[model samples]
Target chain A: MMDLVYTPDQEAFRAEVRAWLAAHVPKVPLASFDTAEGFAAHREWERTLASGNWGMVTWPESYGGRGCDLIQWLIFEEEYYRAGAPARVNQNGVFLLGPTLMEYGSEAQKARFLPAMASGEEIWAQGWSEPNAGSDMAAIRCQAIRDGDDYVINGQKIWSTRAVYADWVFGLFRTDPASERHHGLSKILVPLSAQGVTVRPIPQLNGLPGFAEIFFDDVRVSVDNRLGDEGAGWQIAMATAGFERGLMLRSPARFQQASRRLVSLYRQHHGDLMDPAVEDDVLRCYMDAEAYALSTYQTASRLLQGGSIGPEASCNKIFWSELDLRIHDTAMRILGARAEVEPSGSSDQEDLGTWLDGFLFAQSGPIYAGTNEIQRNIIAERVLGMPRR
Target chain B: MNFTYSAEQIEFRDVLHALLQAEVGAERIRARWDTASGRDAALEAQLRDFGLYSLMFPESLDGLGLSVIDCALLAEVCGRAALPEPAVETMMVASPLLVDVLDRGLGNGSVQAVIEGVMSGDARVAVSHAINPHVNFVEDAHWVIAGVADAIYLLPRDKVEVTPLKSVDPSRRIAKIDFDPEEQYRLAEGEAAAAVLRSTLNRGALSVAAQLVGLSEVLVEQSVRYASDREQFGRAIGVNQAIKHHLADVAVQIEYARPVIARAAYTLSVSPERADIAVSHAKLAAARVGLLAARHGIQVHGAMGYTWECNVHIWSKRIWALVREWGDEGFHKNRLQQWLLQSNALLGPEFTFGRRSLLPDSRVSDPVSADTAA
Candidate 1:
């Protein structure tokens, strides 16, 4: 029977997750991961979650996960966000690369990377966008020449999230010098502390070095680090991008929590913010959040029935990114003049800084994980079968 | 929680689609647009034969005894074809109201006769809820289920004065129905009437929302087909980025609107307490997206979209007509606002479908009564 109600076992699983999260989630929010201390704190939080086998619940039991299905993963996320747990610092590994590795990684690669990744011992950063290849990712000029027993890579990867403190980074590099566009690239895993590697922190709009630029000066790694075939980087990166844009990353629970906060804010200030227009905007944010959640549940249900995620990932990406921005924008609007003034006291500073930080971060959503424009083109050409220019 | 439709639901939709494809077409809708009655009796009989009218009625009453979700699926297909019938108002709204009236022993012989006549395809019912300003398709209806304040009345078409009103959609025959309280047959009054009226409006909104979703799909499909075939500047217009992006935006809107409608239908059937939020969410999204699809469909069709010959206008007009049918955006927004501001209801991802009990500081004592409040 096709049912929306959770099964008995799934309900029990949700109860277990809720109980664990309630007891363990930090009372005070952790600092931004841009600083070394804050990054280490997030890493410690990830390790604590892993100790309870809650690091990556969807991975197989052998990989330190419970081997739960997507539905259970969604339930876990709902509980996690509801409990106000610290953000997943190892998201790049657990959300983006972890699923791709499961799909395309060789047995040796899986055995070597999955356990450490599940345990948050080896945090990962994405190395996709470069100074020249932000939207046109296939135009990457980074090259990794084949050596006797290793591939010597020489490239500069910019906008690499968590590269300043992450242990390893996975990215696409040109393998076949003679090929062009999307054909000659290869996905390779490289350690940030490898010889000939230098990382420079780049401050974001919020004055945080949450992302960095990685320069590879003739870095050499064994052929075992290459995933799949030598010149199949585009396809592999796309699979990873699908996971990043699809169900795993940006779970609906995150926005739901934001919407709930927005509602709470509205309720607290209803006497002052009594305009029907403001009320309508607040309701819209709540509606869009609920709509996105329902849509994602439908997608999760479909995927659990052995269905594959298609260009709908582009659709999901566009919907949620815009939704996040709209919700934050409404929050700022609700704050009104208070939005303009910086907090004067310690408690007020922390309380007000959360919304300010959120507003700044939401701006990056459309730019990262493939720009919304690029996503629209993909939807137009690939999903809708429109003629490509 | 599962969100996909069951195999049976999919099969039911497929059957209705096949029937609509075979019987209802643009040409049929266009033909009916010029007629005085603005209805295709044969098509209505065919749909009735398919058990669409009996979908939400009790099985003991010789009906199919299906839920609102099943009725919503059929209504969507009807909207897709622009079937020019009151399937949504009759099957989804009026039939269930009739059943509730009968179940409560509030129905009289007149109401029973009308229900039998509607179930047997011999009569049609037009509902006039307090929320809707005018009664729709009353000229073609034999019975009018009119709501006045806290009571409901079963008024025969002859007993009421229906002042014909022109609608943007030519196929829709709407009117302001005025009946004397003494002359009409009272079906239910007081709290029971209020409950029935609320249920009627929610189902009405859900049906219209589903129809708007279907119409949105039709607009997108029609525009895509036109763009693919109509060439300009030495190539198909769809190849251009401007046209492609416009259609793509419409597609995205339709993509999100669909699940909202489905979820609303589910909430109506399973969680009546949360029906206001779910239905308003569905109606708001569907109306917004449906209007977007209509505007883009016309823009993509260029000058032809405004003409009577182009099939896009038929569905486009229906979109405009249905946007304000059950409840306008402002009305539903107010309903949601009350829930958010007054009820202190839990608002989060886990509570999307009304898991209020799960909240840590949940105010269980003051459960949201927005449905009744609205």
Candidate 2:
């Protein structure tokens, strides 16, 4: 039974997920459009999953999920990658806020928001990463004043993913000006339809409106919309960030997909007879992917047996992020001349434009989700027990 | 799953560290390097009494049943002190296979006698081969384990001739042992002994790699301290971008290589099948880092580094010799390429493709919680 560590039941689950994905995944041709209609199509794909009750596979059934273990979720992700499902458009809500709400939301808040959230009826966006508070999130200047029954929020959140399309913005605002850093912070869920709120989409390198800059001017949110206590925002936001950094957001299935695409591209273009340096880099990418996959599997297995994540998760995050960059760089090297220009329109080629796009996207990996340098500092000081410099 | 050291391994490391601190400090190491025999017999006996000698062989064959990882921890301490002892050469090389043969009565009692002799501080053994240029003081060995044909050329001193050559490192000497075909108790000729010997050689390289890591670590620490304290003009030399960046680069190299060495050692101890690829990668990474670290250690020391008074030369020379031994960077890289070609046959094309596709988007999201974070 323990030959390859998977059981017949797990295999059966994989088949079931594969079959479901085959039947439901949309076959509409995509042209890499930047219009609202294209994004709407992506959102509709997410809604399809929600309608089928396949959204948030690991969340509680009450929140419109299957309430499955990590293994089943992993299987579902594998199938999702295999079936080439359109990437999730509401990642901020489905991956981050949805999990945070499940953990820390009030009974009233859960009953009010979770159903719509799970059904993709409302889209959510993160309000972290201010202009000056990229890696140092605690230095955010966004402030909130406690009124009689509501908190008036006034600040700007830059690099807010999908904020232009999102119906809700979950953010951290300083509730106590007298208190020091990270103290007196409160997490508030504000409806984007409120007065004095505007979201302008930020142009990314791939010419996609991948993120936005949100301006909140005296936006009033009911105190009941707070995810946790006023001062507990830092901790609750940390939970969301952890999910952002961990398996919930960055699954092994994604890496598996990337590795597969790279190998195909290498074979197609380089045909295994590329420059020795390129071959070495490709080999290194494979090794790093395998190591990361094995390490993550161990982490997931521990979580399945009810073990808490440790500082080593930072190590895992840094490794995969750096590795992701290396693999995409190798793909660019393979693509050679064509890797420079952006793809005009989506050709049927497997990885020509995709690799270039991914290469561009990988540039931000080390900066977002906490910089690689910070992660290294965490690994050195926290995991390896080295003294902080 | 079991990441932390076992209680016994922890205790073993603590005792070994204490012993190394007391008996193999810089002054003692320098004295041993100057001595005719490059070893301290009394201290060697003390280590044997602490069960360090029994670590490599199996418990059934009079060993301590310790893994290569345990031996690696000891190697780190020994390397830091530049201790001139055959701890690694003896344990990693001779103890496992040679002792196994001696215990099984397949080899001469002379092999077993040398083992008992080392345990009692009465005799020493060192290996030499033209194929590998890292052998130290092979002529001085009472017994030499040389590779001739498919079997170990176990030559006694009476049957072989030795011609000593001056080595750059003071802690070790080199000599070619001309093995005479007329004398030897046994030769186990088969793939079994060859496989075991190959594994032993890889483990030996990995042990040295661990030692090199320790040596590089000390070099970085010493260089940083010197940079901080050694002032020139109005500021410390460390304030200079050249000096500071040099030390920082050494540090980064150490970080890149040390984990590979540790992982290789772990593979040798637990999974023999993966040891080939693991050791190749470990050797390639370590050789590059060890050379850079050792050379930079001297460069950071300036004029004083060129002198015999400083112990940096001893560690640097050892790093060079050990890295070049077994398989150097180029040799290991080629080996890795070969291994990859072979392994490609077993893995499906989809496996590699899947890895590439999945790896780029791979993210291990940090779970939210102080308990999880810390």
Candidate 3:
């Protein structure tokens, strides 16, 4: 009955997660995954997590998960972030596509991809936005023409996150040439190493290839690689996009961790940098993180009680994307001149530039997973029942 | 942890929503704006008859003995209706304070009579905490629970001189109360009085927060309705992206504020030790968002928002009055800052609603952990 108090079993589960994370979390932070060595290091960390069956706890046990409910997953995430663990390099696979596959994938498809995804054997990238279809995702002109039991794909996808080092990509491609907009689209899974596929790393503000531009020149994949049915790509992609925008992709723990760091940073410098305005901003980041966490818990509870995610996901997306930007911005403000100095190495104590790097990445939050503007439109029209133009 | 209300709670909320909608019409509240008392006696009587006044009192006192969450649920509805009865202050603040005073054996016959009068709908109570400069709706209240220094006094309204103070919200009648501290009846003093005052202030802040959330929702609803019906450039203004985005921001603010208020209410009922942080969070979030909603509501309605005829100012003014009622943004933020600096609490994902003691052994490095530990 609207119980915010955790049960004894849940508390016990939380204690277990805390103990495990304390023992296993790296004492030193890992390098940024923009570099190949850092990417490999992150992969190894994922393998360590998989060995503990903690890579994706909400997934079914058959896929190396504990089959825990969303609340337990939230608890695990809280501990995972609290312990100062490395970021999930395979978030694209595990948080976004993994849930989508569990929902719409066939038994064989789940058997093939889920284990690899859970084990970090095959990292994934999202290939949603094209040069023209940034916010208007349905305007994607990428085509996957049918050729017997295979589809010959040809398109250029921009802003494909983690594509340079990822093994596979999942995206939407127009299957029927005559159809327009969202109609007759298909979600095709393509291996990054397939013939006629080219990945050009796009250096972000951090001078790292965090995302890439993928050129597909008649890259053929079997028809079985398609998720859901043909002509239903838009719907399936919407579901995946919902998952990406909603609870799974950006868990509250991530923001909470950042908020904690921000608080610590504030405490470290409040003597010299103690402005009421700055103090208020710091408190705002903390409170917003808590609010987001509480809201997510409410959403998870509702879903467990047989509720489905709807346009309210749009509200969540807008709140969190903006909140992510604000939290990092507050941190950078606290860092002042130190924010400009890039870290010489992962162990550089004087390098406060990770906050700067984080700020740069947060700038993309509102622009990705459907821009915050688009999300507001969805909320206004769908959730609030306002009129559409 | 379950974050959803039970079916019974949902039903209670729905029923309260319907009752407020049917009973407390906007015209009824608007009518009180010009009255001297700035209260609708009929509506107050109706609410008391509906058993809202006794929702927080002990069952032995013939109350519903509901949790703070329940009181908050009702407070939101009252805010939505712009209900002008001090129902929130009376039920959520005063009654709870009085109940505690009696339970602590600090209250005498006069306090008991006032409590009985409150349950029977014969008396109306208004609280004037030190945080608030004026006692709200003092003219309509029979008993005024005023906090002076470290002690609390229960005084009959006739024993004090209340000078009327104009509020931005015309329906919210406020006054500066003056009385002889020695002549009034002392309810409690020392630690007992301090505890009662603390609980009263927390509940008062939480009530206003919940009400502000309700007021924000109403503002959003009104703005959306006006945007939909008021056409500009050959279409509804709501179809315009600018208008839609403004309203959507308001909606998001309201959406996030709800859970904070709920969690605060739950914490107040279940864990008093955590009530300060929780209520401060709730108050700051709701007041900030409520003010934003008020500004946006006026902007969305254009010039019509400024006029009395549009009805937007009714809720807008109430939001202005309520934001500073129990605790303003600065007040709550300062409280949170003090707590943060003093305790060095484990500020992280794991400790959002949890105690600092919940942190693992490796993380307890703060000097204040011994005192702050749950």
lDDT of 3 by residue, B1-374 (tens): 78777788778878878988998877888887887787777877888888888888889987888888888988988899888888888889999899888888887668878988998899888888888999888886888888876889888889879899888888878899998876447888888787778778889999999999898999999999999999988999899999999989989988899888888888888765347888888999999888999999999999999898888988989899999888788788877777666534756787766653355565333211222333
Query: By descending lDDT, how would the candidates be arranged?
Result: 3, 1, 2
Candidate 3 chain B: worst-modelled 10 consecutive residues by lDDT:
B365-374
Give one digit per residue, the lDDT tens place, for model 1 in B208-236. Answer: 88898889888888887888888888888
Model 3 / residue A124 / CA error / Å: 0.5
Model 3 DockQ class? medium
Candidates sorted by TM-score, best first: 3, 1, 2
Query: How big is the positional error of residue A244 in model 3, measured in Å on the Cα after superposition?
Result: 6.1
* Cα-lDDT of candidate 3: 0.85
Worst 10 residues of 1 chain A by lDDT: A340-349
- CAPRI accuracy category, model 1: medium
Over B1-374, each residue of candidate 2 has an lDDT whose tens digit, in order, gives 22334557657777877878777766877876667767677887887787767777666656676777778777777777666777777777666657655644566657767767655546666765334754676656677776544566566766767777677777777765575655454445465456556666677677777778777877777776666677778776765656655655555555555545655667676555346666776676667678888888899888877888876777788887777777666666666555444313222212311222232333321100001111
Q: Residue A365 CA error for candidate 3 (Å)?
A: 1.2
Q: Which ten residues in a row have the lowest lDDT in candidate 2 chain B?
A: B365-374
Best by lDDT: 3
- Candidate 3, A1-389: lDDT as tens digits: 77666787888889888888888888878888878988999999999999999989988999999999999999999888878799999999998889889889999999999999999999999999999998998899999999999999998999999999999999999999999999999888999999999999999988899999999999999999999999899999887677544888788999988988888888888887554577878888888988999888888888998887644577888888888898888877777777777766655644476787778889988888888899899988887889987
- What is the lDDT, from 0 to 100, of the residue A298 in candidate 3? 82
